[model samples]
Target: MKKKLLVFTGSPRRDSNSAILAVEAARAARKAGASVEVINLSRLRVNPCRACDRCRDRGPGQCVQKDDMKKIYPRLQQAEAIILAHPVYWFTINAQTKLFIDRWYAFGADEYRCFKDKKVGLILTYADQDVFSSGGVNALRAYQDIFSYLGAEISGMVYATSAGPGQVKKNKTALKEAYNLGRELVS
Candidate 1:
């Protein structure tokens, strides 16, 4: 079977810098012979996790709140690699991305074994060059912790700095790195 890659964009703005990078990554993944799916969190109706613990009690991949997240669950399960692309808001991932990730608690709580050994990649765009924008290195560290907890292998990451709308396109280095990261995940 062909490897499946799922790319999730957390940018709420259409054509945002993060989204552009994500598209590039997805394109490269496709070229590398992986089936790729790109999902925009902004277009989804995912809600915050209510901490209901129903999924834990019911079983793995089960959540009480029926929303667009239901659609995400199946794709996530089927993916061999997962890519998260987002712009930094106050030195962290945007609110939309956070909310989407938070809902993954259901899978985490249930100890879903599907996530184990799955490849994970991160594409982050930030306006600041400073590492201490929101406490020192918190965003990357937080994502690292989450991926580790899920038992996913960190395939690669790209941190594109000084990225504003249309700015990331000019950063040839970051774009190349993002594309390479995608290719690496499938390889």
Candidate 2:
């Protein structure tokens, strides 16, 4: 069966650097014979987790709050690979990405082991080139930890340094790497 890849972009800005790389990655994944679905969190109505633990009581994949997340749960469960694209803000992922990830707690509560062995990728954009000074390193580590906790393996990652709009377009190396990362997820 062909692999299914889910690409989630957490940038609120249209045509963001991270989104550009994500689009490239998705295209490459499709070329590599994987069915790809791209989800732009900014266009969705996902809400922050309320920490009610209702998913725990209601069984796996259950959440008390009714919102757009209902549409994402099934996709998350069915994906063979997952790619998270976002910008580093204040040494961590942006609010949208963070909220979407927190909602995964619902899956965790149900002991949803379907994600085990699935491949995961990350595309991060930052203005600062220095890892320590920019906090990009911390964001990368956080993504690694989260994927690990979810029982997924890191397929690859691309960190693109871009300060202004469309800056990533000039970064041919980063773009190629992002595309390769997507291809690797399917391999």
Candidate 3:
């Protein structure tokens, strides 16, 4: 069966380089025979986590806040492979993306467990090689720490370094890496 890969973009810019790069990766995965879907958090009306803790009491799928997150929960639960494509913001994930990650608490109870044995990847775009502002290798590390607690394995990550607006489209090397990641997702 073709693997179901879902790419969630956290950048506020709907068509940001990171988002486009994710699309490219998904396209590559499709060509390699894997089913792919991309969700742009910036465009969706995902609400912030309410911290109601009802999910903990209810067992599974119990967020009380009625919003776009309801749509995200199911997809994340069902995806065989997931990709978090985001731009580096102050050495961390963008605001909306970070909120989504924090809201993942609804999926875990005792010790952080959800979609066991599933594969996860991080895709980041930076504006410079400063290793700080634009992001260096630490971007992947931040994602690893969170996913590790969630029981997801890091299959691979694609990074576009020293990239600016429209830079990703010209970054052939990064694009190829994205394509390779897509192929690997299904392989």
**Top candidate (lDDT):** 2
Report lDDT (CA) for all predictions.
Answer: 0.85, 0.88, 0.78
Worst window of 10 by summed lDDT in candidate 1: 129-138
For residues 23-129, what per-residue lDDT tens digits would candidate 2 score against the true structure? 89999999999999999998899988899888888877778878989988988899999899998899778888999988888987757686789899999898997
TM-score of each: 0.94, 0.96, 0.90
**Residue by residue across 108-147, what tens digits does model 1's lDDT show?**
6658687899999998887777556632267789988988
Model 1: CA > 4 A from native: 130-136
**Model 1 pairs whose backbones collide:** none
Model 1 residue 187 CA deviation in Å? 0.8
Instruction: Tell me which of candidates 1 and 3 scores higher on TM-score.
Output: 1
Q: After superposition on all CA atoms, how large is the RMSD of candidate 3?
A: 1.9
The alpha-carbon deviation from the true structure for residue 88 of candidate 1, after best TM-score superposition, in angstroms, is 0.6
Ranked by TM-score, top first: 2, 1, 3
Pairs of residues clashing in candidate 2: 60-110
Model 1 TM-score on a 0 to 1 scale:
0.94
lDDT comparing candidate 2 with the true structure: 0.88
